[model samples]
Target: MSSSTLFSPLTFGDFKIPHRVVMAPMTRSRSAQPGNVPTESMATYYAQRAGAAFIVSEATQITPQGQGYSFTPGIYSAEQVAGWRGVTDAVHAAGGRMVLQLWHVGRMSHPVFQQGQAPVAPSALAPNAQVWIVDEHGQGGMVDCPVPRALTVSEIRAIVNDYYTAAANALAAGFDGVEIHAANGYLIDSFLRSGSNLRTDAYGGSIEKRLRFLDEVTDAVVDAVGAARVGVRLSPHITQRGMHCPDMIVTTLKAARRLSDKGIAYLHFAEADWDDAPPVPESFRRDVRRAFGGAIGVAGGYTEARAQAVIRAGWADWVAFGRPFIANPDLPARLRNHLPLTVPDTHTLFGGDERGYTDYPNAG
Candidate 1:
């Protein structure tokens, strides 16, 4: 057996995890159409990977307005909640704990998904990003995002309430907890970065003002389901899709401190994972550790050795793996046994049937 700390157990909020391997939230876009509900195939897919210490489910939209990609699941309607209940039940029956990731895409959406209306953001700024969209003919392609309209203050508060409702729905659907998707260049991330949020209102201007929306959303989710059941995902170093904020590091650190004060369960960082992506500085990692006292998780391109190094240094409590878990359902077992991982077929990464979803075999 590997003598790495990655196999060590740790107390994370409500549950005591067996290892430091976390199945990161990945968007596969395989939800049933017309209502964007979870399917039986998704349940099998997650249940097959139940050997992980814990799973952070795919990004589930809080409302229809939060959807940016095609075929992604939601947690808004009763039918959707029932659909997820099946998935969570399967995971739990397989002896695993799972958390639902609540998401709002904001300006990352297209008019086609927005009912011919412009998408809403903190300001009327376009991220110049593209979201995967499927047309009436069932053809999927990347579509450029258009400029969004600034959200009224009342509308912002309504979105916060939407998060609260989503958290409640997650618990009702049998989720162990809910992770607020405040990462990437999504709605909450845009509000945090000065480059996208040019609003002169109470929701923008200074860093504190920009953080107000996230604070309210977190508070609302905490109210819906206690602080121990809440986690926040932030991407301070991911400067893609027009998310170049000069003061993002500082803003993220301040947000981390506030989330710590709220007594949230964990704070996850979605670092840039591409081969050429800039590395997350060690100084910033140290600073974040000082800022947030709760469990800290990080997701990027982490290998076993790298994950062990970070955990040993006390920089992160756990390591979340994304693509690695796609083709290797029994990822934790494979890693522990030093087995070779199966490579995922890129063509079937999103919006596909079970060919690439649950077809991977365990290394028995």
Candidate 2:
């Protein structure tokens, strides 16, 4: 059990990574105009950090209905697909692998951002925290979440198809794979959380029923992109966007055990919160590893020591660095060379130019 093991090669499906370092999905919200397409600058941003064994891009909305924020990328339209082609090509040129994050924000959106359209969710519940609403010019404004309208069974089916269409679009765009965003209290997470989903239909009520939305979407994505190229991003036992389950550990195990049987390339688990999330107790990570022998990548506030510990302990196949990678684009090299690290500018964390996005110093 040593820190060096974190940098070891690990195989996930057909992709054999030279290291266990992964760049987690980050919401840079920097996509260029008209449908929030990926830009050339973003390509340079990702290509610079191509050293990661795996790179999951920021949340890409499935469609206009799936979008919850402005200036974020999407995979629904042909133009959007073409835009991402530039990114995928750049990452490949740099010898890196990248996966597109498929997302739907559910009640996390504002009417102001969605062309005055009301947000939709499993129930008409409002999120406990307020979302940052963006104006036409992408100006950030704070507003309390409005109660969302419950989707009918038919609309739910349409939403599922939206995910499929986006997955197909992702493949056509030349992405290596797709990661379904089933966490962070998004649409899938909203339906998964008992606090958010209060319906008594086949899509809600019991744990088995509650997990249906996520399962259907996963099956659709896998079918469209092949399971080997489809990964899942899940935040279990964590209360982001006011997620609370009666018994998270039990619920998650029951839901995920079946997913493990379905043969996904990997499971990217966000065990806890960024600030107050409880530590991933030895037992929790071990249990997941035992349940799914497939590749498992863990993310959160972690150091080189902690990342290596998880890998050495055989609890996780890879470790994803969030803010550390934000401040240090050359994080893998920095860790390998034991270079100095800089503190990220909190103010520039969201909505800014290259000052904090692609301008991070490299380990020369």
Candidate 3:
């Protein structure tokens, strides 16, 4: 209870958060074989920080086609479900609540990762970054991203089924809820942003049309798993690779309004991340909170002081911790005791041993 306004309890989705510190869904890319199944080590990692009010699992691909990065976990297969079962069991045993983040990389994925199939997106445009392709030994090979094949109307409907499948998997795996990864230059983001989506189809024209794909995906997840258990993450300003949501205020407000109709659980708005990324004004959060009467969680490089400032001002219901949780596994205790944060080692961020994963100390 000794927080600078960061340790207060808040409602996130269907669960009551003991503290506002949320462990963000960072892609560690360490899933084991066959279908990106989470291993026992992954469960141990999450359970170690069960004191967190809530935990959002790493980006779990909804289907094989949804995978853009290698080793990223998935929740669609029976094996994957059993794997995540171990994760949820660990978290719950440690008295923590966790949600699954379903993702599809869209144009960000390489054909090399899709069993030699071409990557697909709203349009045939390729993102401006390189995708790490996996070799026979599962090593990363950074290569230029290939242009994605345009998703036909039929293909769009099929992707909707994938969301439902993943949602069911989430429930079967004992996850308290599910988060739709609609932001951060992924498939959903590509469809929502005007720059990437140039299709003349019903899903790509004006703002309303651009929102169709996302709306459908949300509806599917909600239908599969009740609306009260669903949340969406959106990065309005983070321009990943070549992706850009320049008119973030407009898109964010509209996206909030569109999602409002679904009566969904919550909205996690990712303002910006990069050092040069534009700072999202508090007005945007106010706008989203106004448009979507449901809960709103805000993230992106916010320190303890800044996080408390926004929450104290009633701008957000929750603040997700990314880097802090990575280095300081005992983050909640650190915050409660006013302990200094440990610096995260960038080298072991993605695919590495447990040194940086769970070895950080909270206090002397």
Candidate 4:
């Protein structure tokens, strides 16, 4: 298979990447506890994989109320910001450009992480989803999501402001830019789908209304950080619990136009990647290209051949590799030379210090 297109240079917003292989954000749960702050080990982990043209840091909560999983990093607190500073510094020192993903779990969160209060959402609905959490005993496991409280109009405005604050914090932490995590059945994704949002307010009912929340958040974030430095992640096909909607494709395409109007840097599509994952229609890809003027990045179970094909076809500008970058820190170099890759150990995928993290060796 021809992998030549993967090495082509591309300009994303203000950053010029030397190659088209990007690093997708993967949660490793290796952050320091007590405050859910990033650690120096996390810095080393990112620095080790600086071969990637661009790196999107793991989903970092915008505030305490935004956190859904334990040990994930945050950007709201001073300590958290300082912790992330080291991470960005390390990645930059290795000559890698990086962006921080701003996140809010919404109803995906459990009361255990919310100080005994129900998680907030666009509507008071249960996703029947589960999130990974660590108890006081330090045992981590998945627990079912509880029904969330409907957010009032005022509360929605506050959350939008929270996104703005987080974007500013990300810049201060030394990131080149920020990406709004509006995918994978998270807060913004849930708000954009009908199955999860059943409100009669201005932020619900019609497709335009369901998309209102995302628009507001995007506007706020772009306002805080210039649109040139802002990007957004969207999953048009994933039906991860409480996120399935009949018109997801149509809705997402319409939203793409809105994002394009804002002149944001890029649109990162989180495609389904599981063994039985459904395929994204080529029509959708073509339509997205027509709607957006900026670059497009795609992630999910992409092989070297498939990634090259997508870029060659002009359907995507860059490809993001999640698990492959975990075990092969020099993935771009390995792919450049057509070398074999090492599979990561599933057991040490999360909550570890550095065994499966920074210990991954470069190609011989």
lDDT of each: 0.93, 0.84, 0.85, 0.92
In each prediction, how many residue pairs overlap at the backbone (N, C-alpha, C within less than 3 A)? 0, 0, 0, 0
- What does each candidate score in C-alpha RMSD? 1.7, 1.7, 2.3, 1.5
The per-residue C-alpha lDDT of model 2 at residue 280 equals: 70
Comparing 2 with 3 on lDDT, the higher-scoring candidate is 3
Clashing pairs in 2: none
Pairs clashing in candidate 4?
Answer: none
Task: State the lDDT at 135 in candidate 2.
Answer: 70
| Structural similarity to truth (TM-score) of each candidate | 0.98, 0.95, 0.95, 0.98
Across 140-187, the per-residue lDDT of candidate 4 in tens digits comes to 889999999999999999999999999999999999999999999899
Off by over 4 Å in 3: 1-4
Candidate 3 has a TM-score of 0.95
Q: lDDT at 20 for candidate 3?
A: 83
How big is the positional error of residue 169 in model 3, measured in Å on the Cα after superposition?
0.7
Judge candidate 1 at residue 293 and give its lDDT: 82
Question: Which residues of candidate 4, in runs, are more than 4 Å off?
Answer: 1-4
